[model samples]
Target: MDIKKIAVIAGDVIGPEVVSEGVKVMKKAAEIDGRISFEFTYFPWGCEFYLEQGKMMDEDGVCPA
Candidate 1:
């Protein structure tokens, strides 16, 4: 079995809404594979955040705490 890390940036308005469905499908597909898994990390940095922080993502796209 193997684990995969997926970094998703559902940036701006409808981005999250659309990505959610895609993720849902991917999850189901992963389940059928049975030997692979997905680890999703959502980064809350987008246009709204950029308005406040002036950056779309971190220097490396990592979520800052």
Candidate 2:
């Protein structure tokens, strides 16, 4: 059996909270089944981040390639 890693890209304020809840649910389900593993990465990018960087994530915040 192979375990798949999931990547969650949280974009803004509410994004983090929503993603957190989703992860919680996944954990519960995995605990019940006892056969799944997950990896989560949080990217901090939003209004506050834009204010600091002077650019949005879509622009130059992250390079495409």
Q: 1-65, model 2: which lDDT tens digit per residue?
A: 33656757666656877988998998788778878766675666778778998766656445554
Clashes by residue pair, model 1: none
Clashing pairs in 2: none
Candidate 2 global lDDT: 0.71
Best by lDDT: 1
Query: How close to the true structure is residue 44 of candidate 2, measured as C-alpha lDDT?
Result: 62
lDDT of each: 0.85, 0.71
Worst 10 residues of 2 by lDDT: 56-65
Q: After superposition, how far is residue 54 of candidate 1 from its true place, in Å?
A: 1.6
Q: What TM-score against the true fold does each predicted structure earn?
A: 0.79, 0.60
Residue 46, candidate 1: C-alpha displacement in angstroms: 1.4
